[model samples]
Target chain A: MENEIAMEDKNSTFVVLPAYNEATRIRPVLEDIARKGYNMVLVNDGSSDNTLEVIKQVKKEFPDKIHIFSLLINRGVGIATQTGFEAVLKFNPKYIVSMDSDGQHSADDLDEVIKPLVTGEAQAVIGVRPFKDMPKSRSFANSIMNILTRIFYRVNVSDSQTGFRAITVEALDKISINATGYLISSEFIREINDNNIPFAEVPIQTIYTPETQAKGTNVKVAFKILLQMIKHQF
Target chain B: MYLYALIFPIISIIAIIWFITRYFKGKNSLITVVLWSIFWIIVSLFAIFPNVSSAFARLFGITRGLDFVIILVFVVLFYTVLKLYFIVDKMQNEINTLVKELALKNEISLDDEEE
Candidate 1:
């Protein structure tokens, strides 16, 4: 009876990770998360590489420390994250945290992102990556998106594009998500604005790799973000 | 005959215009409106103008330009729907990936020692 009650209370928080082609680093990520004492979900976005192999290995070693969702085909990051959220809802977790699988976000920073959602101070808690690690052009683009989000939605968010965020199940239920691709970030801000949901941001560290720096947001993604925002602005 | 043809086309034209207006207002997909309007135009041309109908039959190996237009619109609409379906499919794929990851995490967290 005591264990049953404890299990019911245990579903208060969940850590969601969306991974694609991150075999080289996923094992270490899972290891690091294993030390943090939080539930972890890894969404493999249909990688065409050894990502699944690594996940299989991790599952064998830490069967309870890691869970893997191997997609049959590649889906965009937004959809993967949303699907994770919907699944976690069944557990009735009070707070949900979304982190990147590429090692860009630190598991240590999970507390900062989950604070607001857990405390009832804000409906959403976002991890704002320090501008120092980002390229100037990317920073400029994010700033523009933030400004636009504020001007159009009357809300101020430090980082609208950051993958690290936390929100309550209630907020998750209220927020609308229509985007399937890269534009989901903009759609998130739009939904939050349209619904007038309360949100806050905490500064978090960003780790950069040679590949991540080289693979910054492209023109096509930028244009998509702009078009998505324009669609909702009217 | 002329009056009947004119009236049918006019009504279709009005419907097309209304649909286009709604599309411009972001109430519908633009491609949807264009596809439907093109359909109505072809129907109107064949039904209202017999000279055009007969000219089309004589000039080309076609029987009715209006019928051709209907087939063309359906083809275009079919393609458009297919393309949109793929987009939705892709989106659903992402959602599935995310859900699977979450399920795995929930399972692991059960044994997570942080409590």
Candidate 2:
């Protein structure tokens, strides 16, 4: 069953889910993707809970639509997503779409983002959430990240921190990344800018759960990203 | 009896320090020190104060003072494994990001060639 599922993923677009200690929400997200007929790779980022166990159970139930990779220790979200990104690279997918597993990102918006990648209109496409659904604090943080990317990377992206993004396997290979959390999303955009990969943004609806609102952007996270940008400068 | 009591505790204390120093110098040396210290402590206790050694050993479930050293070594080993796991996890992510970015660039070059 695993081999058959692996073969199925070889010919399809890949969705990457970077999850950590999200045993409660991950299963529903996995089921949503399976229903959409899109193959996904869930990177279990060293979650101390039953996150890996949940994925194993899902794999047993829906072997073809979901594949998983587990890291032994809890790394940050950036590392977990990168693990999924690497696995998708091996499968040779048409497009790679990565989203969070905390139930903040909608699997339904995937098509809107993947469209550009599928049509070759852009090398990478990001789904930007409308401001109405975003908290004021988060909106402000996103603006700060965008301005920083423009200053360092010279590219003007609407929302640099949005996780709903799709890129071709080719672009995924070229950009060098140096992030392990929220900053990774920004660094990815900077990579697209550095390499001059054509990128597009499509407006999508984002529903902010209580969990997401509580976990909103912070100054420490911003500082970590600034440090990452400094490292890139050198 | 008085002389034996004073010398035995002193010897045990010295043996424990020596065991810890060897443990710090190299991990491999810890096993040797622990084993030999356990042997010596047990022998000294029997020769000097058999009743006290037997009573302490039964209460602690450790045959000798040196057996406690082996337990300490296991604790350190477990902590080391947990620390290494975290470091490895972080490093793998950094490497993966590097690879993905490299792949992304290669795709751009291919696109340029087609253009």
Candidate 3:
């Protein structure tokens, strides 16, 4: 299994993380992924905090392993993540993985999250968590979004909100991420479903803290996502 | 009333003169100048001869000329508004494309890490 993985890593691959004002939480997250020896791209989404300063420190330590793109303005998660893709495409990487910068997603799940793709079982892989302890309003909102995804996009993944996802270069080159906001999660599913790209999910753990909870899923933002989903119904 | 009659003709004349100057200065397109000229001419004619609108209304079997004029005004406004919306949307899309291209160009590759 180890030898098989070395051969897979020989191909161009990268992990992209979208961060916004996560100056304090990003250190452990980047360090964990770097220790795993994966080429990474950290796209700072115009963070007002010392996030870019921290990113600069990481780049200094692992200059050859990590690439950075500091967006001059806060565009949103969709565009920031898209910028990550644009940067990774320059290296002609075959597999591109996207993860969060809030330290919620673990680097340990990277192998399993990309497992289905490694075995040729699926073109895309996403992380899933039960969220049994998830707050009431947040869980209810996720349930509503999950149902809407199934009803419209025909995607039945256990978790659609997880940012930890892997996709093939084929999927990336074909689908365009133009939503320009947080709606990219559902928009991502919509594209995969409409393009008939096979996908699977691996169960993963989510470590929530007061910081993560403070950045809750907002109702107004969710409404905007719904409107965009309806407008661009796949 | 005489005041009502003179008011529209005066406004129509001013608009027509303004449009002509704009067209000559290249601030307005030829089609725009022609369209507005025709619109103001008709307005001034209707104001000068109020019976013509009623006559045309009678010919078309409409209830009243004022109603027909009001309906025409709304239809033109709606059509122009829709056209403006498309123009603005196209401009916005163009700007987004340029931003993407420039952002990609400005990307810092790991190979070129600062020394």
Candidate 4:
């Protein structure tokens, strides 16, 4: 299923969802995004599960409302997202909002995230989640990442790990990343900060399920992120 | 160890030969070949005359020749690491492009089939 109207709308806002194994969880989220009439781009990162089928089913329902892309293999979240960004930029969209497909990000808060861009308040808007409500361990790691980013790169963002973000065409054009892993979050902040892009944040509710809460940033992943940051410095 | 000095010359000889052959075969750029050639020459020199590093070290007010060689090795490794990082970064970008194009083409072709 393909959406002919995917990029034709000059004034339309796009929501790009990079899916992994979100087969069951994202079915309803896709429905909600489609129900809201937002242009959708679903990127399946080579899920072994039935994610591709779920997206295929959703696309069949809203052929004119969404575009679905599945990578031939599993490239991590960063690579999938970069694919989505590159995919949407071809249409010359005015505003592009990216969210995770794991149902952590709300389709309803889509409006608020993109509002800053729509109103010309900020060229880039990050969907900041309340860390206090999160699990202690994951929240602490995220907070350390935020602090490290500010200390090392001189960029201040509340939620450095938040996947939900709204960026204008100009801001998206300035964003270039070389990470194939999770450090794309840090790369995004560095790109915006380096280019002096106007950045803003809006509070968004993060609905964490049991699975979401359990998927914490372990030591291995955290070390990789730190190594990527240090590697990128060179 | 004194034995490390001998190994450095052996490794340097191999590197020099490899780089020269690669340059002539058009596998490496002329600049890279020349740079590697100079680097190996310095390594072989220091390896053969361990006291040379000490003299050089004394000029910079350092203590021992082995310390000087170790410092040089660290610098070379650091430079190599940075260069390799850039190559890896470029490969990542290429992968992103390849994946993006493949996904888009697949989606478009499927849509065309439906039409």
Candidate 5:
């Protein structure tokens, strides 16, 4: 498996990291991924911190392996991720994987997440995190969102809100993302169902530092997502 | 006869005048000025003669003129809110597209510079 992955990592996979206000935590994540030899597309979502500087420094270190873009203003994660997808697609990679930049998604899981796409078993793969390992508030919100996604989109998945997922270039070409916020996760599932794309789910490690825990969706955001879902249904 | 009846018509007349002035100044569209002027005129007429509103309410199967007014206000408010939501949503999507395009263009220019 190691040899096979190493051979495939020769520019066949591009990892996308969409970041917002993650200046302090993004360096280690980027370095970890860079050390693994996979190409990266980093979208610095108009972060209010020095995240762009950090990204540029990292780009200098791995100039051949990284492509960076910065939105002039902070659009939400959805648009940022979509922009990353558009940027990476031009490179003609076999697969594209999107992961959070706050270090919640471990780089070690990158190979496992991309394996199904390589093996012809699935067109997309979702890196599922164990709810039992999450904080109570996040777990509760995730559970509710999971149920709502199942109900609204008719797609069943254990983790509907996971930021770590991989898609084939073929599947990526078939779908267009419209949501501009965190609700983009649900929109992905909707696109999968609508396009009849094959998908798989794999368990992945999630590291929840205080910073990561403090940056995700809250009750108000969840409510807005729900409203957006309803609006999309019609 | 009542103080409210006298005050409301005066306020409505002022609103009507303001709407017409805005239209003349090119700050408001013709449709907007017409609609607002009609609305204020109705309010003035309703305040001066409450019976007319009651008659209008009966046409809508509402029992009281005040209840009809409340319902009308809510419907208008809801319509305005929905319209504004769509406008903002469209503007946001456009901005996202513009920003994405610029970012992509920047990436291409950077690649050129590196070469």
Candidate 6:
């Protein structure tokens, strides 16, 4: 099922994976997306590890399909994803999907996430995860973000912090993200609301390993994100 | 006179001198130098004659000079902090833009080499 969708719109869709210090886990994620034949944009956020070397090695196998971008230093995930967007925009793709590199987001769900965009049902699509399936701490943090996003941006989504989402090129043009951290996810929802863009949410499987859970937003990061949102409001 | 009266005036004078030196070195504008000098001079006067603060406080309808001084300090600190916050935010945005552009430029050059 995923293969048919991938082969049909492979050239028009670009998958952007923003990775930071994912040297131990990035290869399989990249290979999975590559095997699906989607054009890949891998942004290395100045990983202190040998993540860049690993990306370069993977690029050797699919040199034509894989595009590698390296930040000079460790900018946060927000800017890293924005960099990927800028790089992929040059190629003029129809859809740009941003994913995490920690193997939390499944490559199999790529088709489902992009289905709304393909069918012209929505301009932007967020791959929502079942909160019940998430770890308690992460689930609690995500719930808080969801409520805050609704309050601040006046847009409600079950998951505002999910990296697994797809946006059409036209919709992407109307949105500008200035956040340089995890708060970028919230910024996306704000932009969508501000621009009056059509959006949808699809349920995606959540695979949380201990490493993945330990990496992304924790309680302290959530509090920081709340502060950033308030700052932007004023 | 109290010990703070002597110490504060001396500190204010030193600050005024430093501001003048910075102006002479072209690191500060004339307006900035004048404003800072006026501020420090006022500080020195308030420290030398604590009664003047009481008089000014009466003019502002405040009961105590100490209360007036505390309020003024807070206002100044708040303004300074807000100004610094905005400057830092602008710098962060500029740095992000520079870094993103550099990364994209390097990728374009690599593409050119491949072609």
TM-score of each: 0.65, 0.64, 0.78, 0.72, 0.89, 0.91
Which candidate leads in TM-score?
6
Task: Encode model 2's per-residue lDDT on A80-173: one tens digit a residue.
Answer: 6776777777666878888878778877776777777766789998888786567877777777878888887777888887888888888988
The models' CA-based lDDT, in order, is 0.71, 0.73, 0.79, 0.80, 0.88, 0.88
Q: Write the per-residue lDDT of candidate 1 for residues A203-223, one digit (tens) a residue.
A: 999888775554435455666
Model 3 lDDT tens row, A48-74: 999988887887787767788877767
| Candidate 5 per-residue lDDT over residues A1-234, each given as its tens digit | 445576555478999898899989999999999887789999989999999888887888888788888899999999999999999977889899999999999988988888888889999989999999999888898989999999999989999999999999999999989888989998898898799999999999999989999877666677888999998889
CAPRI grade of model 5: medium
- Model 2: interface root-mean-square deviation in Å: 10.7
DockQ of 2: 0.03
- Give the clashing pairs for model 5: none
lDDT of 2 by residue, B1-115 (tens): 7776677668877877887787887754766678757765765665576565556556778877445545645766787798798888777756665644543333211223247
DockQ of 6: 0.51
User: Model 4: which residue pairs collide?
Assistant: none
Candidate 1's error at A156, in angstroms?
Answer: 2.5
lDDT (C-alpha) at residue A114 in model 4: 72
The per-prediction CA RMSD against the true structure, in angstroms, equals 10.9, 13.7, 4.2, 5.6, 2.9, 2.6
Question: Between 1 and 3, whose lDDT is larger?
Answer: 3
Q: Per-residue alpha-carbon lDDT of model 6 for A44-156, expressed as tens digits? A: 99899999888888888888788988899898999999999899997879999999999999999998988889888999999999999888898898898898889988888
DockQ of all candidates, in order? 0.15, 0.03, 0.29, 0.33, 0.50, 0.51
lDDT-wise, the better of 3 and 5 is 5
